[model samples]
Every structure is written in structure tokens, then in C-alpha cells.
Target: MKLIKLDAIDSTNDFLKGLSVTQELENFTVVSAENQTKGRGQMGAVWNTEASKNLIMSVFVKDFVLNPNGIYQLNIATALAIIQVLKTFNIKDLSIKWPNDIMSANFKLGGILIENTFKSGGRISSVIGIGLNVNQTNFDNLPKASSMAVVADTVFDKEKILVLIVERLKANLALINTNSQGLWNEYLSILFKKGVPMPFKVKEKSFMGIITSVSAAGKLVVSLEDNSFVEFEVKEVQMLY
Candidate 1:
């Protein structure tokens, strides 16, 4: 794997996207930065982090899954990879909030954002940007934010954690082509709030529901009141705490 270390940038995903278009890059090529001025999250949300205190990186992956319908496999495989890495480091109570927010006991520990590039020949490549709080200790006003240092009571080597996560991603993504169902099952087992009653909001309505399972297309499947079931795409519904 080729690694590029930058002092800082606007967004690692944007940098990787620029590189992928400007020149040929090998699969598993990585770009890491010490800070980001315009870090992004799912659905255009801003990713806020303390400078040089977290793992900010993007990875280029190619020739994995060509089927557009199977894109959610990338998310499942990626989430499991990070969860597994944290497990090895003795980070406890890890769970994935719907889609791909990494959580530990209700606190946000990391996140994953994947952007894909498509070619007319049915080939696809992805730039996966991962942000994990490593040594940062102060969250200030971010109530749900926490870090490995706070959760595990020790400082961490951010580079080593990045290497482990990338290695696991490579292995997990390789299995997705044939063992997607297996991966999906594994993802569901650790899914946050599964089988528990929770409140949700849709457009202008509010209701209580239970998160049952995720659809193959990555929609959150909820069992609502009155014995009804509904599926919601990401950002279509908000889970109210």
C-alpha cells in the first residue's frame, strides 16, 4: 500500500478524488493528514476534530464490487473493519449507529464516509475517508464526542491504528463479493438499538419504532406501532433520542 502523509488539507476525500482523476493510483493507496479545514460527514455535515489529535485519512480501493446495487456492501465491510480494530485495542462497548457512525457506549468514537467513482465499463473505485478520535481528550461543547484516550484511559499511536484498520478493510472488502450475506449478518449483530423501542421523526410526524434489521440497500428497517414495518433511507428519517 502506498501512503501519502500531508501536513494538512481541506478534505482527504477530495484530495484522493483529485489524485484518482489526475493520475493512476494503486489499490489500497492511503492519504493521511494532520488536520482538515473542511472535513465532511454524511449528508454534508461538518466533521469537527482537534488538530493532530485524531486519525484523518482516506483510502483508495478499486476493482472490488462492480455491481452498483451491491454498494452497501462497502459500508458493511468498512464498519466491521473499524469495529474489529477497536476491539483489538480493548476499546469496549463499541456499536455502529445506523449506516456507519462508530460509537462506544453512546459516545461517538469515529466515522466513515465513502465516495465512489464509476466508469462506463462497469468498473468502480471508492475513496473511503475515516475519522477516528485517537488521542484527543477534550470535546468541549460536543456532548456525544469522545476518544480512545478517554475511553481506554491511555494515549494511542494514531498511525498504528490507521495501519490496522486499513489492513482489515482490505481483508473484509475482499470477502464482500461472495460472502455479503455473512457480512450483513455480522453487521446487524452489532447494530445500535436493534430490537429496542425508540422514537423517530419523519418529515413532520413523530412515532415510536423498533429497529429490526437493515435492508440490503442499506435502508434502516423499523417495526412501527400497530404492527407495521417501514424502511427508511439515510437522512430520510431522524432517530430521536
Candidate 2:
């Protein structure tokens, strides 16, 4: 595992994308930045962060066997890795939101963005980027955002945090290679709002349901008040805030 640290970059994922084509990048190569100028999130959203206040890094993995049904496991594995690391910091009330947002009591603590490059046959590479709020104290514009400092009541050293995350990610990646189902089950155990009643929006209609389980294919299974279950793809439904 080689780490490339930079003072700033447009986006760690973007930087890796550019390099993926020209270079023979190895698996577990990390690209980290002190600041990201144009960070990206799921569905083309911008990932906003204060410079040096968060852990912004990307990991490159190549030669993964792509099971169309198991693609979502990558997100679960990455999210679990982050949560495992945060646990060592003794942060309580931390959990993962579906598809990959780290939350603490409804306030977002971090997020994971996975971008894959495919060749003719299988996955050529995957860039797993993570953004975690660590020391930032204020969240004026972002209402549901929070930092570890707020929850822990103290500051954290960035370098140490990065090291722990890398180690956890490595361990999780190994688990992915061996016991993906176990990893998925463990991920569901820490899911936010799991087994709780909540409102979700689908096709502009709001319905009250309980999150029962997340399918291996990444579809969210929700049980409605009528006891019927519906599975939702990523864009098919939105979790009500």
C-alpha cells in the first residue's frame, strides 16, 4: 500500500481517474489531500468540506471479480471499514446511512463515494473516496452535518486518523475477498434507522414504513403499514430527513 499525500487537489477521485488511464496503478494505492477544490458526491452532488478539517482520501483497487448482484457490497464494505476505525476513536452514536453516509444521531459525520472503471470483461479498478469530518466545530450552512470533535468534545490529529482508516480499510477489503455475506450482515447491523419506522418518498408519494433489510443487490427493503414490502433502487426512493 503506497500513500500519495498532497497539500491540495481538485478531487482525489478525479486525480485517480486521470492517472488510471496512463499508469499501471497498484491495488490499495491511496491518494489523499489536505483540501479538495472540487469534491464530488453521489448523483453529481458536491461534497463540501472545510480545508484540513476532514479526512479526504481515495483508495484504488484493481482486478476485482464483478458479480452484478454483489456490486453494492463494495459500498457496505467501505462504510463498515470507516465505522470500525471511528469506533477505535471511542466515538459513540455513530452509524452508517444506506448506500454510504456515516451519521451520528442524524447528523452526517462522513461519506463514501465509489467510482469504478471497467474493461471489456470485468472491473479494471475502483476508486473508493472518503470524506470524514473530524475537527470542524461549526456547521452553519450544512444543518445535518457534524464532526467527531462535537461528539467527542475534543480535537483529533489528522495523520493518526488517516493511518487507522487505512488499516481498517485493508482489513475490510480482505474480508470482502473471503466473506462478503458476513460483511453485508455486519453492515446491516450498524445501519441507521434499521428496524425503525420512518417516512420515505417514492415517485413523489410519501409513505411510512420500517426499514427491514438491505438486499445483497443494494435494494432497500421497506415494509409498509399494510405489511407489504417494497424494494427500492438507489434513485427510486429518497429517505425523508
Give me the candidate number with maximum TM-score.
1
Q: Candidate 2: deviation at residue 238, Å? A: 2.3
Query: Which one is best on lDDT?
Result: 1
- Least accurate 10 contiguous residues by lDDT in model 1: 174-183
lDDT of 1 by residue, 1-241 (tens): 8999999999999999999998999999999999999999999989998999999999999889879999889999999999999999999999999989999988999899999988889999999999999999999999989999999999999999999999999999989877888899999999988999999999999999999999988999999888999999888998886
Backbone clash pairs in model 2 (N, Cα, C under 3 Å; residues 3+ apart or in different chains), count = 0
Count of clashes in candidate 1: 0
Q: What would the per-residue lDDT of candidate 2 be over residues 1-241, giving only the tens digit for each residue?
A: 7889999999999898788888998888889998999998887788988998889999888765366556677788789888988888888987888878999889999988998777787665689999999998889989899999998998999878887887877777777668887888898898899899988998889989998899877888999999999998876888886
Off by over 4 Å in 2: none
Compute each candidate's TM-score over C-alphas.
0.98, 0.95
